[model samples]
Target: MSTSYDITQDKWERFTFSREGRVLTAAITSDHPVNGVDEQMHTELALVFNCLQRDSESDIIILTAKGRAFCAGGDFDWFEEQINHPERFRAIGWDAKQIVTTLLNMEKPILCRMNGAAAGLGATIALLCDIIIADETAKIGDPHVKVGLVAGDGGALIWPQLIGFAKAKELLMTGDLLTAKEAERIGLINYAVPAAELDAKVAELVAKLQANPKWAVRWTKTTANIPLRALAAQLMDASIGWESVSNYLGDRREAVAAFKEKRAPKLTGE
Candidate 1:
């Protein structure tokens, strides 16, 4: 008999969790126009994976969002706060590390239902998933450099692994967004299907995994993630440290200010 792990007991302000049979779907439910990550959401993102990992009732986990966009990136208000109080940004290094590490440590296979655009940390989360199925109209990218920050979250670690170092450098440096089709062409994501077919495709993949031996499937994912876990251990601290330094830079302030004022950032190479 399957033991029930009550997910509702975990109060999440920006996320909602629900399970059907043994598949738990964790969604980004922030009311932001694009579901941007704020301080609260970031904390929840770091903790949600651990919660889901402990859900013995779940065999598969689907990471998705409730709005038109999966997650557009960081909230502009939150960005400004980090820029203004660089010390506040320091505390997020642990949460940032936890987000990536816990997801990597999860034994259950994660399928990213990329319902819409995913940028910055959103893209990192999607790319780290074992399989990614995106809506054909959606876009994916790590635009951290656009806002004068290093793509140091999981972007540095996962992008290079998925699409190779040369392409990853070009995109991360330029802060370019790729259409779902282009992302698939470059092997950054698994499948780009019509929006209407997104759920059907995810269900199909879920069914295939459910048919297999449970431990065998779970252990296979754990084995496949060994190298990724090693890379995360090696790079996360330095990357997050550099990102924190960028938070204190004049360029970061200018970028956030420009975003809020609806103007181009006047960035000097400060």
Candidate 2:
């Protein structure tokens, strides 16, 4: 039917109609890249989510990307813009809300194919997926603390549920990177396979899910995902609020400065 949104930008970002059935596949290219959740990307992603939701023929969605990194998370340029003009912070908050809401509420199963390193919101996106399949060599982290920001939107909602409160705190507080196996071991991801086998593994999983009775699958998925939805509803706002305030604070400023200078950050409560 409406293949219009099926592919807006060829490899930049696209939805490929699967030959097997009603499953829609999305590829996020590493070249044109998403530098975190910015305005244009946010809008386009929302459009993609909406399109996927409306496509009745689509029973499952798979998100994967090109390159050695899945998503680096928020564009520092946008963050720089926000710091320079604190008034625009609310928009970022709204975008964060929308991104989480769209993924959490998707009626069909959403799977993440983590082909490479994913940090910050990138890791968040993977965690939101119904099933996350990562390459054994791939690394994932939530480095908001390293960037002088709080775990806020993504970490605040999902980390505790995935790995328990203590480990989540340790990782989030230190901004530690977890190998794919460690991620799976900690329950952060579903499986960790060889990088070369990632696509095949993901296909096998998606196909299996797709071939199952649609209603039974959907109901099971819907029930299981309710906890995530509830967590987001209760925690995301407060988390984003702290993150917005962090943008105006010294820790984030030092963090960004250190990143730009390629040096260690020196944080001060001020």
TM-scores of the candidates are 0.97, 0.90
Off by over 4 Å in 1: 1-4
Residue-level lDDT tens digits of model 1 in 9-93: 8788998988889999999998899999999999998989988888777889999999999999999889988877888899899
Among all windows of ten consecutive residues in candidate 1, which has the lowest summed lDDT? Answer: 1-10
Best by TM-score: 1
RMSD over all Cα atoms, model 2 = 2.9
When summed lDDT is taken over every stretch of 10 residues in candidate 2, the lowest stretch is 7-16
TM-score of 2: 0.90
- Look at candidate 1 and tell me the lDDT of residue 69: 99
The whole-model C-alpha lDDT of candidate 2 against the native structure comes to 0.78
